[model samples]
Target: MSKKKLWQSISIVVATLILSFSAQSEEIYTQNFDDFDDGEIELGDGSIIAGTAASIQGGRLQLTIDGQGLGFSSFSIPPLEGSSQGFKITFDYEMFDSVGANDPADGFSINYGGAAMGELGSAEEGMNGKGVQDNLSFEVDTWRNGDAEQGVNISGYGDGRDLNQLAFTNGIILDDGQRVEGTMEISWYPGKGASFTTTGLNTNADFVDVETGAFTASDDHTFIISARVGGANQDLFIDNLVIETGAGGDSDEDGLPDFWETANDLDPEDATGDNGAEGDPDNDGITNFDEYENRTNPQNEDTDGDGLADGVENGTGDYDGPEATGTDPLVADSDGDTLLDGVENPTLPWDEDNPEKQPGTDPNQFDTDGDGIGDGSEIASGTDPTTEDEADENSYRQNFDGFADGTTDLQDGTVIAGAAAEVVEGRLQLTKDGQGLGFSSFSVPAIPGSSNGFRITFDYELYDGPGANNPADGFSINYGDAQLGELGQAEEGMAGGQAIENISFEVDTWQNFDAEQGVNISGMAGGADLQQLAFNNGPILNDGEKVEGSIEIQWQPDVGASFTTTGMNTNADFT
Candidate 1:
């Protein structure tokens, strides 16, 4: 599921107990606005625009003009009563003239309840007409006023004269003029609950639906659509308004109620025709009849509220798998991992129907493979989420066997040579002779949780060349806070200048004296002389022959560090 769907799913629930019955549907109100004169002052419903800044332009209800002064206008439909069955209100609207699309100063809303028509309640203040007692407003707020984020905002004024924001959308912005054109549907089941859905919004491929929990059924309601503008403004217009009240019966006996069909813009009297029970209006594979029976929205492809289409959920879409996900169609997150099923398993052609097949992460388990890192985190870190990495998520190991002639790219770092350094016999040869100064810096990304300390281990081989007793200088492993891919000339086993705070573990091959020989760990705190942290002299070489050994260095902040050598031809183990 997308971030938007994840947020909205918290409050939405499948309405399974909604009582369905048989009754004739009534279209109480509808206005296309095309019948009115281009610049008519009077609306067809015996109502006039209550605010002077708004008017009917080009046969459309122009709520606010672009770049115009503060605008607030409202008009009401004929009064209607609350029904025990249900009601649906739908309308298409657009905010254009791009000037203030991002933050349009203000926006509009649809208010329903006992509030009087033409009151223009808090419209002047960019509110849903404050003091509109016993009314609920479904508002589309463009401006971010105070603490409330912009988008679909549902607020209500109770009998106590108190106003409260009831619900809203999160991480969704519907302010762009190019894609803000949308259609809204308000479906209310009186005392049961209500759902507010918007389509063609900018951020989501599926409709954004917000469900309002149960509320007391109002006895009578006066519906009003209003808009406003403050210092900034955009052209806002409303068209194709529809409102239906009362219950609907299965007119054609196709398992779909008449009121449901009408509300979804389907033909109620036809069973086998277009928009009928057999028709897949949304093309989600599941027919209208299945949608009605399953309690999913017929006009929405993703009725389960995510990127997964309903057809895919029903095991009949683009997904490829040996077994199909039999997840409950009404459930959003099947595994309770705070991630939707579709989001956790986005890959196709799975060997199993398990939602966790893609990226080797299990949708059934948040931390697949029992790794401390979450599956999402592992996937993001370029690690196998389904497997427990021996080096953990941020750690990686690579042997430069190939790429002898080119750069070797590995997880967490890249092996790049500098001058004398080259890949020889599947190994990085930093220097071939005693005077051959070379350096190869592998850019290792700092692993997370490093404050707890980290360890580095590597294998090395050194031998006395022909006629040479031993290699003169030696190599060192350096770690420092410096630029990426930065290195200093290789000499005395140091790779960076003294100006950088660098720590080095140097192995001296040609010892000059007791103090200048053996193995030494030193550091430079930048702008200071090198300071020895530790030293140890051990049998790390074989006389006139090849010597092989492995070294391990572990460091922790404040607690200092330790160095250990293994498999060395020494009388005693070196630490």
Candidate 2:
């Protein structure tokens, strides 16, 4: 071959190699601090490391106290050419020392902009530490400032743009004072905008993704991982940084990629005004830009089919507030507790701590109280969701106050024993002048022997007999194994004929004998013949006249039984 022909072939081969390199994925930067000494870092490039208090320790960046009550540190990388296809930056971060402490101030961020480094200053400065224009920053705010704003924040800055501040109401995204370990990812597509994603940020989320709408992507950009602590103390650390370039493109310059726009029937060219990224035709309060980011349907209000609008569940758009649910928009069951977020809270701006419109459980947590039972189960079982506690499922209760309307009947399963027992004047009449005996029984499921305890309460009145000085046989409150309707003469209440082991509280109005007189609490073990009084008090009943009072009996398996009586005339020990 001739020399000119050989040169032509070599040039063609060189061009092909360059094309392949451009199309392929490449890792441009990575830092783990594995080889760095324990002290100030040495990046060797035109990198800036601010705050002398921080150092490279334990193969990670350890940032500690820099000032007396406030500390600040920042690590900035030199500008590098951005990939036209797409680029992804990932790193692991942790913040500690503010777990149980009060007022954990300031926070941390990962800033990408034209500036080489961020200004170590106020948290309200857009990026937590703002300095450059045409910047985009992701922040993890740890404290609630005077403006009543905290949690995770993502913002976009430009010269002629209205500062795009992504809305999120999860105050304090990182767990205070605890050692929180989480991964953060920043993906940038030139001319198409970027996305910020976080996983396990102690935010009770599997992952959270936010986006920046159509923005001018710079040809080259620098990075800064910065943190500040003011009016409180905290330690922030970072590790396992990786930056790479791969394939992604969005023709519309919206947050949604080209393929997604095509699939969703959205015009790729229409990203401005009111019909594309900024549009919310469904009126669910979530813009089309966010619908794409959340992988939800832009045309549907309840994209997850969970009976809740995306805005209500995600605390976005019109639902943004200090009391929003902060649940996942794309998921039906955000906490995976077998209950949908909509079913748990249902309304926007619901407080998990105190529910007013509905019995709102925490949509972000399965067990809101860290109890063994989930919030779904707690709500269903009528238990408190905000505290670790047990529920007494084996119990029965009845209130007679509703019966005062004279329209209600006895509660279901209530057993009335005897012809004289009836509901008259909105009260249970156990006995009348013509009838000598009556009984009312309520049987509850047996409680286990190794149980907490139980309580019984009652109110009674004895009035209007044939003679003013002579009342009837009186009444008794019984609990135990006894014949349901055993009524014996004028003496026995529930401890009458053929009774087994039981406890009976008897109020004797007739005073048949010395042993059977006064108010008595007796235990009938084998039979009525073997009954003995556990408590006895002198006569307190107003014979044939009005005498009203209440009684309470509490029994514990380990502590035995105790009794309390009210409105009794005699000063006697009922316990």
Candidate 3:
């Protein structure tokens, strides 16, 4: 059964009975997320696809992906009576794996009834804007970060993953770098937990014993405490959760019902969404409730991404069709076309005016051009939406006449990082001259591989650097699932400098111990060991030669990609 659906079977009576059977505390309230019905836990934000659909699998809450599921899933936290003397939260968290091990690697956070966290349409950055004013977050950050909204900065040097650092921010803090592994705990003692000298900074925070590693809570008022976890790759597991209250068994000052916070895992201190009438996160010109009913993100403006506003798609002003009809707001393109849902729907298609124009194909047809290829595929391939001619240049990925059309166009699909690309006449002239060097990448729209296989063709001319028989740096072609912008640099240039999980074919014209005038393939970027594709004893391309070539890579589902090269250095003519 689906993890969220798993909680639907447990009734309120059973819940109460389970609570009654557990260790009843007039002061402490806790939850384990076990033995509960489906509705007891919530995770519509894709927590299921990240790792396992079963949230309680392996007896712990697992937050695995940095892409798919990066939202908060809350469970009930018993209401804390207004007489808050002390509060402490402890959980187990480990950085399962960093995203590409890139600098500023992602992390996760443990928040108490604060803001609704998680990116609606994307994975959320770690520990950012996830906590509320009255909340305290044990931010186990793996990346160097700072939140201006929360007034906390912990920017440090390094790629930032292997470092296990922890910080305390009650919406503010003095970031004490604490490394944790096993069962890490953050507890707020009662001495200075009543009131603070200030409200925003760590100085206003109740003193923390850096030596003893203890915390004090604010005694300002009896606050209701809630709990949630907003994560991406920061796999956290929860077991013993204990929160102590001031007086009665329920929240008194928050004016909320006794079982509300505990039932929904909300903080009584936050009169926001926990009360069912909270704030809108995405600023999409619609209330959070409307977003919820419409199954859109209150935290994202373009939920379905139909080009029209979610509010407009909801049949607002000038819209008088069926309620929530005309154009689907939650689906970017309802017809499975790569085109936005707002295009060619109940209205006319977008204007196909220019060479770069979006196709005006029928919104209902997968292949708007009737070319046997889906409209989405045609669009991704950068072909004209109205053409069905397979031999047309529009159908081809690139035609050297100065432009490489389709989804993998050199100028559109890639950024010139650490390099200069000059298109003179009909040829792409790449240069690494003088003391400077250049590098750029070309993206080809992914194709049907493993069965029909895939073929990519490109022509290149590499110029020699102003070195004595050695050029500045060589050029390379690396392919994998990495982003399209760069070959490897994190902030500048390309993503190729890093080991971005791709096999690289280096066409070197520089003669060095590691580099030579040859074609070498390596899984490692600039690593030692290499497999030769086409080699020359001396600097070959330094003669200002224009070489045409193609790397044909084939793939199978279970099996990986294998490649072959042809037409290296125009050997058919060998001029």
Deviation of model 2 at 149, angstroms:
0.9
Give TM-scores for every candidate, taking all chains together and pairing residue i with residue i.
0.37, 0.38, 0.33
For candidate 2, the 10 contiguous residues with the lowest summed lDDT are 400-409
What value does the lDDT take at residue 555 in candidate 1? Answer: 74
Model 3: lDDT to the true structure: 0.39
Cα misplacement distance, residue 557 of candidate 3 (Å): 30
After superposing all C-alphas onto the true structure, candidate 2 shows an RMSD in angstroms of 26.4
- After superposing candidate 1, which stretches have Cα over 4 Å from the reference? 1-27, 81-85, 100-102, 123-129, 145-148, 161-163, 171-179, 203-215, 250-575
- Candidate 3 regions off by >4 Å? 1-290, 295-339, 346-359, 362-456, 459-512, 515-533, 536-575
For 1-575, candidate 2 gives per-residue lDDT tens digits of 77744754564455345434653333256666665557846554445677755678877887555223546777877654444345678888776654455555567767766655544433323442243555666767766432245667667554323244664546555544556678888776532356677776555222233445323345466667777776566667789877666435667677566755665567777787545788887888888887765656777888777667877766442323324667666556666555666656534333445442244556666666675555655555566666777545565554332121111124333554454554455356666663333444333334554247778777766665544245546656666665444443333545445456666666666653345566666666666544545646456554445667878877666877666677765422465
Candidate 3 minimal-lDDT segment of 10 residues: 155-164
Put the candidates in TM-score order, highest first: 2, 1, 3
Per-residue C-alpha lDDT of model 1 across residues 505-533, encoded as one tens digit per residue:
66765543435656777767754547667
